[model samples]
Target: MRRLLEGVVPGELLLHYLSLLARGRLSVEEAPGLLDGAGNIDALIREGMAYCHGDDHSMLVAASPDLVLQRALARMAGHLAAEHQRLLDGQERLRAIQAPTDATAGGAMDQLVQILTDGGKIAELTLTLAGSAQRDWLILGARMAADASDATSTSANCRALYESRCVASAGERESVEAVIRAGGMVRLAPRVGMSMRLADEAIALLPLSERNPSGALLIQSSVIVGALREYFELLWERATPYGVPDVEEGPLPPIQMKILRLLVQGLSDTVVAERVGVSVTTVGRHVTAIREALGVQHRFALGVVAVQQGLVE
Candidate 1:
């Protein structure tokens, strides 16, 4: 009952009941039962008045009149909390999607031609190019078209083409950060590498890459663009939005991540003890803590789980 009072306040219970209605987790006819029935409410109210219990009476009245009315209206509206969340998520998705612009077939320049021919297209575009001379040449040509006064493309939306970021080592992460800071965009798997800050107007790879003769596959369709935008947005949402720290040589201290990094470097408890300036026993304590945190029964399994979770290089 103490724990119940701490967590499940009467007001909160009222809100949860309303949320159930909104979430379609509750039904209207069942409201009387959930509210402990009109007869029970009346009996409680009578007891409250007899004992001069103002608080209990207030609770009973609010639950009876306010909650019952709110729940009834919510049921009529067919409110379901899950459905409301979907509508909200859909709105967020729509905000991220660049409106569909005409992307016609003139090879790599199809998107460019479509935008120009349609006119008044002001959506941000992300272009990926392979590390080839022909693709570079095509990028140059596209830049020229983008420079035209009649072009609807905004200079703010045009970002630098970037290679996929590889996270084989911390040094590579530093290089990737430099490129991203210099306005480069990367295509990466969600949760593959260490999280990095990114620009808003970015691109992500589809489940499959498109094949083209020009060596640079132009992406302009709204559905594909929207999907990529959602992925980048998901990464951006999960990533440290601003004030990211620079890459350091060693892992940050006092967490399972730090212990796992040391383990990955082939350091035993004794060697790790000297390096981290803790005693062997203390290092063993850390190892125990890490194993327990990761729920692994053995030391060897710790490394396997750390690698899989991307806690180590």
Candidate 2:
């Protein structure tokens, strides 16, 4: 089983500990002795294969092998899904790069589109454009919050339009709020099909496809940049300003309210527990109670509903 789980369990020491726990060869007390300089018993506990108890003398208890395997497989599935999305994005970028370039007024395609295949180069160019913008910066997408933040910090006026569905998660909401708080304007559209940035009407950065961070087309041609700016303006006119709901709800207990604020800020359960001076289990219980109070099912929806109900700011 250990050999089969080679890459799945992450580390050999952790795998050995899991196997020992599953085989009942390692007792709770004896487990601590196995923790040498290279061994990390906490890894097993974090992966849901083991747990600790007792306040003064913490003891580790192993979970069932079935539960451990299930959790490991679930984590692997998540990684595979992310990788599949990346592959699709890469394919889309490849197709765009291979397509015929458009001719300008001079009947030449020179310097119209520059393919940026390196992620670091893409980020550096984005930052440079944002920092150098003196008039205005326009953006359309979910992942350009950092660029918007930079633009707002400069002398340039920044305006961003994002799809409502794409910006629903807590982390996304927090980022959008950060941009707004930095004096940038944000609007929500029903759908934003592409990721793009236009700086001062001189240059445009368009990702090859949605969610493709590593590849983009940097366009300096005035014709294409002008068209993209017009497209952004048309969408901006129809989009709604980013604003919180006007509805109000009953107040929650002080502790729950604190937890709710942290949750809305996109803090994880473990971090929230530490900040609130409570156990993770207790924090989870409060999370469930908060969800019920707000009438939301998932954690993402919980943050959205909490903000909508004016329960947390």
lDDT of each candidate versus the true structure: 0.38, 0.70
Top of the candidates by TM-score: 2
Cα lDDT tens digits, model 2, 72-171, are 9999999999999999999878646645543211122246778766666566667777777877877788564234355344446677888998577888
Candidate 1, residue 240: lDDT:
32
RMSD each, Å: 16.4, 19.4
In model 1, how large is the Cα lDDT of residue 278?
Answer: 53
The worst-scoring run of ten residues by lDDT in candidate 1 lies at: 132-141
Output the number of the lDDT-best candidate: 2
Task: Report the poorest 10 consecutive residues by lDDT, candidate 2.
Answer: 101-110
State the lDDT of candidate 1 residue by residue for 136-172, as single tens digits.
1111111221222211111122122222334446764
Tell me how far the alpha carbon of residue 99 in candidate 1 is from the true structure, in angstroms, after superposition.
4.4
